[model samples]
Target: MKHSSAKEVEVRVKRTFLARKKPTNSLIDGQVKISIRFHQLKVRFKQLSVELNLFNNQSSDDRHIRCQRIGTRLHIFILIGSSIILALYSSLTQEIHHETILNPSETQYTTLAQVLGDCVVCPCSTFSVSHETFISIKPIYHHICSGDFVSSAWINFLLRSQFIDFVLYSDYHQQQQQQQQQQQQQQQQQQQQPQQQQQRQQQQQQKPPPPQQQRQQQPQQQRQQKPRQQQQQRRRQQQRQQKPPPQQQQPQQHQQQKQHQQQQVTTTTTTAQSVASAFWSFDNNALELYNSGLDATLSGSPIYTTSFAGYGAAISFTRSSTQYVYITPKVLPFNSRSFTIEAWIYPVSLSSSNDYGIFGQCQATSSNLCLYFIARNNKLLCGFYNNDIQGGTIITMSTWHHVACIYDLTTMTQQVWLDGSLDGSHSASAYNGLWGNTAIGATFQLGSASTFNGYIDNVRFEARAKNSTEILNDATLHVYYSFDGGSLTDNGPNGINATAYGSLSTTTGRVNQALQFSSGPYISYSYTPFYFLGISGSSFTIALWAKPTGSYAQQTILLVEQPSSWCVHYLVMTSTGQLVANCWIGSNIATNGPILSLNTWTHIAYTYSTTNGIRLYINGNQYSTTGSFTFSGSGVPMRFVLGGDRVVRQYM
Candidate 1:
């Protein structure tokens, strides 16, 4: 049993040993596979390194070959490019030459010798275009030190290739220069032509000696022209007797002639000065709108010279139906060819649809020659009717505005100036309206066309075409009234006295002393005819300042009445203590209810239009309104009676 057990143990140990051998062989096989793989990998690495080195050497040689091929190709390209460039250069040169042939001398370019120095030793064939050549083409590149190389053959060729382009633009620059020169020459010629024409005119204007017989003129004129003519005769006689050297006598004779010419001009001017003496400048404190020039005073003095003159006292006219200034018709020189009329005016009130006369020698409504302010359109009409009244200007009211008009009979041109600016111009084709009917008129008048409502200062009427500057700065005025005297005195040569109508009181005012109308007459039950205040048309506005003395029994502040004509325009009132406006037109009457409180000074305005009828405003704000009304009854001459109605035989 022990032997059998021992055999079994040996068998088991052998089995164990066999199993261990099997595992060891597997481990040895795995290690052998790993060793073979490492050897194969190392060999593969060496082979790869050898192949990599060979590829590197071949790539280096390939690069060298590529470089040689590229260099050879570049040389070929350069040769081909040179040929193409040469052909282009030839073509461009031909084209430029063709253009130069067509326009001839009209376009000229800088010659080759001008652009490049005259290098006779260098053949143009030696020129070749390159990057350097193009660099030279840049204008600023000229500063580079190319020295004489710029005149070399290739540079000359490059220039020749682009010569047409440069020449074409250069031709334009030349044309511009030529045009400018030509224009300057034309301007010079034009300026010289006028001067030459003026010289010719002066030469053609030489006049023959006047007739020995002296013509009729004013006393001042006779002395002036007579002496001037005698002096001119004496100068001519001296020129004939002196027999001086032609050279020396030329300047002396010219100087004397110039002086003599000036004297002659002064003499002729004096004749007009004598006539200008007929002009009326209201400078005196007289109740008359007098003519200091003609020594003839105006007919009626509804106005007076005030102490408000900037130069002297200005003429103050009370806007009245009966007051108007007039000069006798026969006094004006009818044969005078030209006339300048001007004045400075300050409009106290400018209402719509009213005409404030500035001055007139004829009927204002008939399109005759007249100057007036048309309040409807807010325009100044300097009317000179050859056939119809025409020329005018737009002028702002309330502020001081200077108005002037010039009538040149020779040219028949009428120019209107407002506030030192030319307003408009028109041609007067006929003479009958302005110059022909001088004797038939009632009188040359100032103020109150119907009624003029403003102050007039520096009134001027001269028979000469004077510009605004000349008129404003005139040293020798036709009529001048300084208004420094209490009585009317002629400041001009022709001193005419004017008649005073109504009594006007002087009071301390804006300047020296202003004419003051009694407040009782202004706000009480009295009314002035106020011809200038006659509201016309279907639409009108009434604006005024009123200080209430604590409303008195439905007091009528203002009223418009036409006596027995059955015409009533408005009746403004202070009812209780409230302000109200009532308007009547046609057969309809409208009321703009109570608007403002009384007892305090208030500005009340009522606008009446055919469309809206009536609109009431208190202190510039809308207060009440009314419906439309169509005005009729021959459009009565309605005066906007302030405070009460005492005109046209009516009452408060």
Candidate 2:
């Protein structure tokens, strides 16, 4: 009857319902279960409300605080949206740029600025970029990369091992052995064939004659057989007379020998066609003057002593027993195909029996052979793998001698030259098929192996055989006028003495003394040796020191002109005071050079070859080059005129 508030009434009703409940097992259990479930639901709702921060079913003041929190969250979300929109709008409107840098500076670049976009702003100077500019990469390698397993020493060790050496060279050795076995088998078969034929003939002759023929008409048969035998013998004699005599075959044999010689010459000439020449002046070092990359290494303290008569530097091997210069044969331009080796030697001691090496390449350490040039028995000797030639001229002790050894594979000849004269020569036709490979690992030595007790200088090597004229001249100095000793005598190896036609004086030269040319004067010499220069298209160098006080229109410094042809090679000064080197075969190749200062001593050098057309150098600096121009002429007579072209009346 007392109607309280809604809450009081609900609680009073729940209590009355629970108090009035009967003790029925099923109904009571159901009601209690429902009540527990209701309580659990209330607890779970409260927990969920707390987790969500909902603040539901609370007082006004609490709800007001919850409302304020919700409003603040909404304002934060709206501000985030506005910031995102502004960034998107700015990115869409702005032009994005990227940059690339190939080589970076060493300085470290650092920045603390931030960008909202995915990429950073490029520098002002850069408009485009590569991925490499921003991206970084690191490679992860296998463990073997940091080890020494791939070093050269390890590789060489493996190569030098016995197993590797056998594997590499076994095929070559087997091939050689098989060839020898085949040759022996062929010889044995030939011998056995002739023997077998002889045995068959003997067996046939040894058999007894028929018994019936012997008994029946022995005398009659003998008489008939005698006449038959006489007729057979006469027939045999006629056959012998019909055969050609040995004298008749001599011409054919001579023809074959000539053909063989021609083939040998052709072979050697082909080998000599390569123009590779090396020179070691021994002035101060063993460096190759030709730049052929054949520089040598000295061993065992060989002295770089004074030259002959103390003029220049020369290597002295007499001081030590095991001193020598070693040149690796692998770098030699030519092998045993053809070669020429020459050296100037001043022997201080002589031995009649002991062999002394001048410069040689031995076949091996055990076999002392294969291009072994030496001085033995007080004479020079040149040796090869198959044959050797010994010099006849005795080498005097303490005297300077120019020794040269030449082997021509084409001609099958070996020659030794002593002081530019032929000292020994012999046919090496035995080398036709017997010359084995002179292995590159062979020892190429100078002044060792029974030690050359001497001074050696001016050593030269060529891939081709040198003619007598070339042998008489220095390998490079074809023409040199020292103008010393108060005469126009040549200081070069070639003794082509010059004759001055007009007033010429000797003065202090760049070296010892120089030729001073006056107006209307020139020097002339025989040009026989120069014939090869034009025909063979070989290289030549002309160098001189000049002090000029004036310039003229086309003045000649040196000239080489063919008598009947217009094939002219001249070094001249043009009207513009510029130096010019011209070579005219049928066409012309001219190289213009810088003008030389007047009244100054200037060094001018001009070099010409078919490979290098024309090169002009002033004071050792190359001024100009015309690349390669091949020019050749008929082997006509040529005249060399110095300081003027007397034939054309052009003077410097």
Candidate 3:
């Protein structure tokens, strides 16, 4: 069998093929095995040959190309088959994990190639399937596989479920946050409430007790304490009484005490005469008598004297067609008696001789007496008249003079004062008699006859009169105004027509003239508005006499213009008794109470100032007031109107 190498190999191959073909079914099986073996052997021998060639010739490009081509083909085939198997396994696992296909039915064996191809991007060797494949597939493979095996309903269900879960979670979180905020606010309020309550309690504790309770207890405490004070006072008094008197008290002390007692008695005597009767009659039997003897030229005429109620006597001298006659009265004694004589006189004509008409005498027919009066030539005279001769001085008689003759018994000097001023004085002789008489006769002829064509009233004669120093020292005179005619007029001389508001009338002697207004018919020449004086400072006080006929439509009682300013000073009632004073200082306004009444005379006064604003008085009592105010301008002007203006009213 080993004839030659080539012949022997060929013979063996031929013999093996014949043997395999001899047994038919067995031959086929053997052939198939041989083919598989041939294929494997061929692959192995080719790899061996390439390895041998690579070893023999290292730079052969042809053999390398053939080997790379075979390897690439095998890798492609293996990748395709593996991707199919992995895709099927991944699908089954995803279905089990998501529970979408758990307990598979008839659809369990479905192909997974389409799902894998739709889910995977590249099906080459680089592709891989994993458990996180579903998330990676949502954007790309979800829409892609939606038209393939997966239903749109399933995808929509999944997406809707996820959105609802997100919404529910967000709402729950927000609700929790709100609840937390509310709890924090509640805690803060709880903490502050106690503090507020504590503050309220503190305020209540600090509050004072009611005024009524304090007032109710005050009097009781005072009553209980008063007895103790009284007891203490009594003890002090007893101690003082138990002490002995000092022995060092001298006779000077005794004398001082006696002098003090005498002073007290003198003060009591003076105080008793403080309120003297206004109707004290003049002593006609004084030493210096004006009409002493009955042998005077006025003996044919009746004597003139004042009544108790009347102020002065009106003496009439008859005129035999205007002629003058002389009359003289007997004088009496005078010794150290201080005397004063005052008379109000009005003459009809002052065209006679400048001689003595009315005189006061001290001796028989005027031996030594002071002549203090006015003469016919309008000259004032004040000196002594001696031995029935007028020799002192002379004053003119046309106008009236408030003549006052003061004789100082201590100084032994005679002085005359006119209208509250010292006019003249002279040395007087000493006389013994301290009584006198006065006379009225044709010597003081009226209208050039015994018929005196003049009037005289308010004649006053005082013996032992107080001096100016003594009168000025009186306290009553300072507090109240004197009823003398110097400050006010109760009645004019010779029963002249005059009246006062809110006074004791001369006719009735009762409280009358509370409210009054007067309006009259026109007169040619007369004084219209009345006069008021003695007003000072910034206060406003209005007092007048008003006689109203009927209820007037518009009546102005008082209107005071402010000095250099445009504001009204006061407004008084003419139709009614109301009194109001307004002071505009800068920008302030002050008002007083009403003082109104009708058809009667009233004394209404208003006091307004910057400090003591306004005070209203009816009669003599203060009625109402306003608090203090500050004034704007200086004050009201001095010249103001009362009643009605002549140029405006044209009536009296």
The per-residue C-alpha lDDT of model 3 at residue 305 equals 39
lDDT of 1 by residue, 228-247 (tens): 99999999999878777689
| Best-matching candidate per lDDT | 2
| Ranking of all predicted structures according to lDDT, beginning with the best and ending with the worst | 2, 1, 3
**What overall lDDT, based on C-alpha atoms, would model 3 receive against the true structure?**
0.42
Alpha-carbon lDDT, every model: 0.48, 0.62, 0.42
Residue runs of model 2 more than 4 Å from their true location after superposition: 1-275, 309-311, 333-336, 365-369, 429-448, 475-652
Cα RMSD (Å) per model? 32.3, 29.5, 57.4
The best-first sequence of candidates by TM-score reads: 2, 1, 3
How far residue 348's Cα lies from its native spot in candidate 2, in Å, is 0.5
Clashing pairs in 2: 98-128, 99-129, 264-410, 265-410, 268-410
Candidate 3, superposed: residue stretches over 4 Å from native: 1-313, 316-334, 349-353, 365-377, 386-398, 427-437, 441-453, 466-652
How many pairs of residues collide in model 1? Answer: 21
Query: Candidate 2's error at 211, in angstroms?
Result: 99
Candidate 1's error at 20, in angstroms?
99
Number of colliding residue pairs in each model: 21, 5, 43
Candidate 3 lDDT over 175-267, as tens digits, reads 566688799999999999999999999999989679998899889989998998999999999987886566545666766996896564443
